[model samples]
Target: MIETRILTADDWRTWRELRLAALTEAPDAFGARLADWQGDGDREERWRARLAIPGSHNITAVLDGRPAGMVSGVPGPRGDTAELISLWVGPEARGRGVGDHLIQEVERWALRCGVGVLRLAVAPGNTHAGALYRRHGFAATDEPGDEMASGEREIIMVKYLTAEDRTARDVTAGDLSGGCAPPADSAGCAPRADPVPGG
Candidate 1:
């Protein structure tokens, strides 16, 4: 069974290891590279700060007591928005619903924290991830991401966590996929927040 829970201090090592793996394996998918994070003088402090943000949440998928996948989100500058980040699944864990569960867990955390919108970015070459996000109701935004290491573009996507489009509803993990419309690859979609923090 895969268990999902909030990341704790003790999980820092696992978090760091999985993050390094993601950065190394899927360089284009994430904004930060291993070189940008490695050998930082205050690596521990940075990890603590990341784990300490009030609106930030990390969920890890543990199978047989080992971490297999993880996802995290932090509040955006806007009060009702959050940015999904550091999403990844181990090589052995892919195609087993781990990615979906991680995303669903992030959605639940966003709703529980009163965030009405969730934003993310995907490398244009990462069709699998793009399709997964689309299947879960995320719509592409008009904004484009920064140039990736692989020279391909990235696309921004967002999901609104409200009912009736006027009133804020208590969103749950299951609500993310409820009544979501397919996204068109046109330029008229709504604008989305920057996916990378310093981008």
Candidate 2:
């Protein structure tokens, strides 16, 4: 089973490991690189500060008591807006429902915090992630911004948390539109797809 929990300082080591893994494994998907983090004296401090910030929610997915994935979001410039960031799932956990679970957790957290909008930036070449966001009802927006990595363009996607989404007491990942289909060998979960633009 997959479970989601808020990240804390106690999980600093796990967070660091996963962060470095993301940077190293998918440099073009994120702004920071492992070279940029290597030898940084304040790395731990930076992580601490990030977790300590107000209006920020960092979550990790645990599969069988081990960290399988992570996702994070923080308040945006506008009220009722939150920016999704640093989403990743370990290789061993891919093709499962971990990614969807993480996203649902983020949505649940955002709704509980009274945030109405959730936005995320995807690297133009990341068609897989773009598809996932599009399935979640996140429409591409014209908001231009710096690319997460050099030489790559960023596409902004937004998901509006309507009143129904907030009031629906037991909303699960299936209720949303965009997310990777679960693996065929897994439980008898039906797989579906929606064509996403620019993917």
Candidate 2 residue pairs that clash: 135-177, 135-178, 136-178
Error of 1 at 172 (Å): 7.9
Q: Where does candidate 2 have its weakest 10-residue lDDT segment?
A: 190-199
What RMSD value applies to candidate 1? Answer: 7.9
Please provide, for model 1 over 20-112, each residue's C-alpha lDDT reduced to its tens digit, 9 standing for 90 to 100.
Answer: 888778877777777876886228766655554554566788877889987877767675677788889988888889999888777766655
User: What stretches of model 1 exceed 4 Å from their correct place?
Assistant: 164-199
Winning model by TM-score: 2
Model 2 score (lDDT):
0.68
Write candidate 2's Cα lDDT for 28-139 as tens digits.
Answer: 8765667765686337776665554455667788898988888876666665676778888888888898888888787876665566889888888878788888888889
Best by lDDT: 1
**After TM-score superposition, what is the CA distance of residue 60 in candidate 1 from its true location, in Å?**
0.8
Residue 29, candidate 1: how far off, in angstroms?
Answer: 1.3
- Report model 1's TM-score to 2 decimal places: 0.78
